[model samples]
Target chain A: MTASMQSSVGNPADEKLGMNLTLRIWRQKDPSVKGKMVTYKVTDISPDMSFLEMLDVLNEQLIMQGDDPVAFDHDCREGICGMCGLMINGQAHGPQQTTTCQLHMRSFKDGDSIDIEPWRASPFPVIKDLAVDRRAFDRIIQAGGYISVPTGTAPEAHATPVPKADADAAFDAATCIGCGACVAACPNASSMLFTAAKVTHLGLLPQGQPERDDRVVNMVAQQDREGFGGCTNIGECSAACPKGISMETISRLNHDLLGALRAGARPKS
Target chain B: MKKAVMAVSGIVMVLYLIAHMIGNLKVYTGRDSFNHYSEWIRTIGAPALPEQTALTIIRVVLLAAVVAHFWAAVSLWRQARRARPERYVTKKAVAQSYASRTMRWGGVIVLLFIVYHILDLTMGVVNPEGHDASPYDRLVASFSNPFITAFYVISLLLLGMHLRHGIWSATQTLGQSNRRRERTVNAFAIVFSTILIAGFLIVPFSVLFGLVD
Candidate 1:
């Protein structure tokens, strides 16, 4: 078994010790309340602990001390569910290309001080400390993010002969977990990278061809209506993406959009 | 759709800049050549299209392009502002360029410069000499003044910066960018804008410093 796959708890024979660190965390009572950075120190933190686990320790401490715990979003601590996201040290997903949940405490030294904050886009209003509403992404997806497959027996696995290149590209585009780190990292708060990832993933497949024209058109319209900034292609979104969704997907999105328009898919006026 | 409008209109303006810069270079060839070239633009299509018809058509198209460009720019700016209604309390710029950051203000400066430029050169009303002079004489007279020459230089520099970011952005908007070609695209933006700016600047600087009289 890999070292990481081994259980993280109760390995006392290992000489690895705990670290003491300072955290500057954003705190707010709720969406209506103003938020600010509140500092708290955590001691005796195991290097084996994931970043969220360390946060869990801090929350435990806060509860024992009769103080409000710093609020953050997380579901699966393994990083696949895309629920947990944080801007650690001014970087989306904390000093790594992976999600916040996968980041290990060992990445930091004992004396390190980390600054944590919530995603700061207008569409994503703060719900509480370190948790902003990401339903804008959901709205974008609902607009045209899926293909229509009839309810029936499953088609033969090889019935559709997709080119290997296109299948690979589609899979690459599908890795996007809808975490909103791209929006958080963008200087303009643009969601082009996320929208494009969704657009390209389905658009590349034969199953997605019937809705191609309408999908790009409707998805982009929803994107604009959500108050996401126009993409100027500074490319910070792709850079901050934990899944490494490429900027080329945005280019593909543009190509598809233009094709749709030229093909008489009138965007909602 | 807004981005596509910005990209297409921006390309039209870039094409106009290229043609204008080449026309400005004709002044270095002497008075007859410069004046003849200016006259030639008006006489284009001649009897087939009537007097100044070609020039009129060009002017109308250019004006339309400029309007569309400005409208798209303002619309995009509004959307960007609304996207982040509340600014980050602590922000760090990661992948943006200086030129990209300064685009809005640079555009304002360029707009102001265009107004002064038309008044000074196209209309001759703000020329240092009287408005009745020949086109060549007006060109010389305008550049002869140190203050006028300095303003021209400063505006052109800002124009170059605007073009540096604008061209790269337009390319991305038009779907011409990819990972493999990104560096090439950036280099082309820098080199192309530099050459265009230098081409335009050569005229006034040459006249001011007596390289052309």
Candidate 2:
């Protein structure tokens, strides 16, 4: 077996090698309440376990001890959902580009101290411990992220032939799972990457061309309205993004925005 | 829209800086050649369009670019400030460069330098030779003072820092940059800014050391 697989908790030999980690996590009762770092210790963590699973083990221990367990947002336990995120040791979604759920315990060594915090943007106010409000993203999407589709009948798959290059580009932008890591990592807390990804995902296709002008115009307007910081083109967002979304996506959004404005496009009220 | 405005205006300013540097380099040829070029600029549109008309137009365009660039920068900066009222307790730099992060403050210093520069050279108000002397004589006199030379050199260095990030960001803002050419675009900025700033600095340094006279 691979070394990591052999280190699973069921194996008695791995128990001696199990890591004891120190976690300093942010804890808040509610949005109005003040938050602070609260430290906890987890013992005998299997190298094969994920980061979130370590937290799970901590919470299970807490429940057994009749103490309030730390609250966090998570689902799927897999990377694709984009539902889980944590500022692990000052990095978005931990030290790796993958989501917190995908980061295994083996990524760290025994006796390591990890600091976990929620997304820090004002637009993403802390909800509890590691969860923050990201509904602002939904509003930006509602503003113009959708294409106008005819609801009467389903369009044929090959009805419109998309170029090989554009289809790939669209798919690349489409991979953004609305995770708040981009905002967390950005110095200005700009949502440029998220909005740009959505804008370019649709902006690249032929079907997307119809609303391309309005899409860029309104989505950007909504982005500004949400009080998210403007993009300084510092590239922290793309760097911290788990999907590996390219900076070109934001560039494409800028190009579309300029063209839209020159064409006298206005955001819908 | 604002990003485009900043990008376009920044390009206009950089293009003018390149031309300005090349024109300033005429000092090495001889005082007569340098002064002659300055005089030639005043009469650029002499017969048909009238003297100083082209120069005035160029000045007006540069002024417009500066105003537009400043306006966009301020609005975006204010929005950015409002967006993140709070900050992370432990935020670390991942991919951002020191030059990129220093753009805002560095741009302000560069702007101050431009004002001082125009007063000393273009207006001759701060030059020892004043408005009555030849352009070459004024330059030589101005750089002869160690303080004047120091300020000029410092300002040019700051301007170079601003341009390094400014030019690179302009490409990204204009959608000319991509993942594959990230290094290429960045190196282009570093190389162009270094050369342009070096060209300008050499003229002043030469004058300070008595090479231009």
Candidate 3:
């Protein structure tokens, strides 16, 4: 219902019941062209409307006026898809500890000048206004983030006999949605959390034991190769993650990486 | 791989600092006691080892640690710098602690200070009494001057800040820290760095106040 809230369109500020707000949004025509914060006034925004819904209202206004609509990515507006994001007022997913799609407009007061920018990182290049190319993340995942399990019938769930603690921990790490919010929030734009999540998600599993050494080494190499910054363990990535991925996953990655390097592991690629 | 190098080398240096701070507290025992302590460092494992063999080993290890630490830090710094060529137009603080943000530049400052420290204290090139003086006398001579003492204090403060973040970060890098133990690890870093730095700082302050002199 957050995305479905009605805005009193075209109504004067005093006549409308909903809140009026100013948006300072990053508007870039393309990756080659420079971007700037283009301010727009949105009126009669419903308190129940999600942050994206508010933007939706603005984009509607722009389209009606023959102006190019603001571009932002979204799929499941329920926050789990990790498709929608923005640096709403300098925060990765706005002020709330949730995805931009899930963040309700109620968090802001009337007359607020919200600044929306795309994820800022060298690797995640801004594709357009409020949307960045997150393929750097895809490359990182491709770099040994998977186990070499042969294509066959699905194995029995109980066959693995995973320890309860390990299963719980692995599940925690598996929640990382590969959203670049971690990179955007990171001071160095490091993808440690995202990489670590992938590393540890399978790292703690019994099936992950075979390629453990190679996985850590190759993935880390690819991460560096993609021009992502090194991790300083600032804990910003985990803090900004929508899935609430714990920093412990990063520790596990570090531990695995050290052991792999000590054992002289190299990339299978 | 680079983070591991930094963590390992940083841990080595921290271990040495703890021992150095403990030995530094011997200054309160008078000049002979402090001088004997300095000589005692060399005489460790005496019967089986050649003169200064132990000290030489420690120096070699410490030197290796410093070099490795510097190499890792610089490489990581370069990577970080290159990672974000296009800076955020809306500049905002992302790091949790001021100490965390200062690790890179502060480490460089600490390294530069180390060179000055070695020249002044160990080599006695910048020491008022010169290298021939007893270790205690050299120590007293450096702290006796307001400018020298001031430099030492400033350097130690900066080193403390570096150590504060470095300790916690090393744990994170080494996978020794976790969510449940996060607060404990944080407090341990703050407590240990403060105590160790204070132990080192006490001697210079005492000397400057004429207590150790």
In lDDT terms, how accurate is model 2?
0.88
Candidate 2 docks at the CAPRI level of medium
- Global lDDT scores for all candidate models: 0.88, 0.88, 0.87
Worst 10 residues of 2 chain A by lDDT: A9-18
Question: Candidates ranked by DockQ, best first?
Answer: 2, 3, 1
Worst 10 residues of 3 chain B by lDDT: B87-96
TM-score of every prediction relative to native: 0.90, 0.91, 0.91
Tell me the tens digit of each residue's lDDT in model 2 across A30-129: 9998889989999999888988999999999999999889888898887888889999999998887889999998889899999988988877888888
Model 1 clashing-pair count: 0
Show where candidate 3 strays beyond 4 Å: A1-17, A150-153, B42-51, B130-132
Q: What would the per-residue lDDT of candidate 2 be over residues B1-213, giving only the tens digit for each residue?
A: 788889999999999999999998888899899989998998997888788998999999999999999999888888878887766677788989888787888888888888988888899998899978888888999999999999988888888888888887888888777767878988989999999999999998997787877
Query: How does residue A100 of candidate 1 score in lDDT?
Result: 93
Model 2: pairs clashing at backbone N, Cα or C within 3 Å = none
TM-score of 2: 0.91
Tens digits of per-residue lDDT, candidate 3, A76-167, equal: 89878878888877778977778889899889998888888898878888888888888888887788889998989999998879999989
